[model samples]
Target: MNLSEQHRDRTDIPNADWESHMRRLRPILDLLKEKDRTLGEWYLKGETAQEALQHRAYDGKAPAKTAIEALSKEYGRKNKDDPKTVGIWNGIRSDQIGASLSLEIDGGEIFPKSLEISLNEKNERRGSRLGDYRSVAEVLSEVVRTYDSFYVTYGPFFYYTNKVFDDRPGVSWMLYLPHVLTSSEVPEARALIPVTRDGKQQGTIIVSVTDEVFDVNNRTHVKAANDIEIRLADQDLLPRYIDL
Candidate 1:
């Protein structure tokens, strides 16, 4: 999650350096590549999935730097003001992996600087590839480290479960708050994973009730996530989440 300040600095005025924006985006692509080989490849954009796969900026397995530079130049030329979105995936039509990176410019929308990376829920192989909670946490933590995120959370796809989250806005397998909250502050400190940088604890990462990939269909997993949300709400920590 890139902060608004970062976006403001990057997308402000005639001096908006799209090349710098692309440079900053390099780490995210790199991180995705490290997680799964199929991630961070094809540049997808179109009205439909099949059409999106056909949209390409460069050919072959070019280095990220080269691809990003080319994409930056394209965005600089064509999509100056529109909200730009690009999906990422391996080029293979069969057994394809899906992920996306999107940026909302300074339009009338709230959270204009939002950068969303989500799995393609419709993909059958998603469960085998990115269905684990720990794997998801590692990916999210890297992003939190990369940019100034107000807060971050990850949960199973809603349809994967029968549980309903009516009390609060949502529940998740993990929650990232950009502040230090200890065991004393949050009795379940065992779940809190510290996000540190430069030898200092930058924020707190709260995992789900268990260490396993959260199976939303499992009553235990759903209950666990619900319980954590209630506990955090009771502690008034739920309101502390930055709404962005």
Candidate 2:
């Protein structure tokens, strides 16, 4: 096997398919690591990343508070010691869905917040608050957590069955980090890059294109939304999934 084609030992998917995926995905990975500057994976900031949609409320002339938000608030007050729940999302970068919709990302897997502590924070001790870092940092953290929990048990990908909108199952790939910058326009996927640990590569970085890249001028609004997205790791990736 070549360098890019070395990590396909999964029994879940065919080795040939993994090889093909790696071959096509290598350049994208390099660009992500070099130019794109991605933090792989993201956790869901939704009110209930682990649970389904519950109660929801609205603010006047605007989208009201959601059940997840309410629950999060309670957790902040009473459950301070309890690590907040979070999850990662994967969505198709399509214009069909308006930016206002919360259900944009078609698929995701919810996990506990404690995993973040075990993977990296304990090892490197990147003393940064979730609010302070850019979008990529949180996304990268999620990628590692996902790999540790799901990939170790299953493989690089899994069969994601959407609970609500689309009941049909889709093959979901893990370790793909999206290179995202904040913006007002909806985000779109540009490519997927490989994720590495130590000297070897592990996951894929997702390169996303937003209507506008976050900069000083555009960041206020973008960052606010990112603050929310950071709380609820729900961001979109490329529109590709196997109809398994």
Candidate 3:
């Protein structure tokens, strides 16, 4: 899972800095390794341990287009774009943005090896894309189910209320990747940096870590849980993710 191209920034993150950053992050990583004990909101089990929390989108009725749009926008709003935005339950959601993202894990798996997200022909707005994708988006949806794994990043939203920072239409830290990134493609980049998410989206990385990714203040925040001021593309390391 090479996530290099998922970032919008393209600056060179110094090796020395990365090493030092990891040293500071290692302890947290150790804490994260014990993922089972950590509880999500309401003492609900975390991603590794769940109590039958399934994300039933559209009730198999609404078109994927209407479904995903409603899901992203309203969810983005309710939490003020806080990356840890997710609510768990069954039945249907009533929020204008959409259903609450109920992130759950089967056994110890949170991230899917292969993803099957897509927009329908009737969907007026475009969803995620893979420009280099030889097949159409519609076809990819079917193929993804058979894939072993997929490279990906999060979408855009304001961090910390009013002051919104978006990285759409460009490969920001949270680029929408459809292919597996490789060390050969970006030799300088590291793989699986493991960013953390708060609340339900915890233990996840939202952006691509590159030399150029930075915040509005032009500095790097090694601690992901609190780096709300930083957005990956600020430093100039935009990505052009590819699919094989």
Candidate 4:
């Protein structure tokens, strides 16, 4: 039987559009599965399916807020007298900062060791001056170099799952890190650019390190270092495999 006829006679099926939907959804699902595989190895390190989902949800929201807060404090004016500062602060307070980031790896195991930053929010300007480093001493040094006028911090690391469903839409997830750090010893730095997947730029993940946490709608408190999981977002970006 042809595709439409086969689906039509399958009374057990839940919907009439089942076959058509599956045809379109199959590729997306396969892509999601591949993403999950790559991200799972990097971040989950053998967590259960449910555990992975929980981790991604938490990671996505927390770091976005922390990044927003860190940026606000740095650019916002301290005195009540500066109208520009006050205006900027008020604008930020009223806006919502969304999260959209991922990582790009060269092979299956190696992290690219570079990041790219994309700012889509209004009145939001990201700088490299915050205390952002792998160590505390480096953060302190950046502070001295900037003459105590500037600072930088690292945002949270995000993680996600790599599972895909055959009949369901392809699913991807993300988690944001818990702590924020500033650049005290070294100067602010830029993230490395990512290449396109399948001749498209949508799948590339961008990342950067910063020095401080600015103010946002929600404030993020730091969690222990061991508690953070480092992973990138997982989503559908390629075609699926099907047995005819």
Best candidate according to TM-score:
1
Model 4: per-residue Cα lDDT over 1-244, one tens digit each:
0000000112232322212322332332233223223211111111343432222211321222333343245435543222111001111112223222222212211211111111123332232212222222232222222121111123322211122333321111111111122222111212222222245422211122223322222122221111111111122222122310
TM-score of 4: 0.17
User: All models: lDDT?
Assistant: 0.55, 0.27, 0.27, 0.22
Model 2 RMSD, rounded to 1 decimal: 19.3
Ranking 3 against 4 by lDDT, winner = 3
Q: Largest lDDT belongs to which candidate?
A: 1
Better of 1 and 3 by lDDT: 1
TM-score of each: 0.69, 0.22, 0.23, 0.17
Ranking by TM-score: 1, 3, 2, 4
For all predictions, the C-alpha RMSD in Å is 5.4, 19.3, 19.5, 24.7
Candidate 3 per-residue lDDT, tens place, 1-244, comes to 0121111211232211212222222332232223212211111112432432333232222223333343455444444222321232222222221111232111112222222121111211232222212212212222222221233432222222222233322322333333333444333332322322232211222333433332323223223412322333343233222322
**Candidate 1 lDDT over residue span 71-118, tens digit each:** 565567654555554334445445244555664443333443555555
Candidate 2 lDDT tens digits, 63-143: 224533554554555333332333222121222210111111101223211122111112112222122223343344343
Model 2 ranges off by over 4 Å: 1-138, 141-189, 210-244
Per candidate, the number of residue pairs that clash is 0, 27, 21, 54
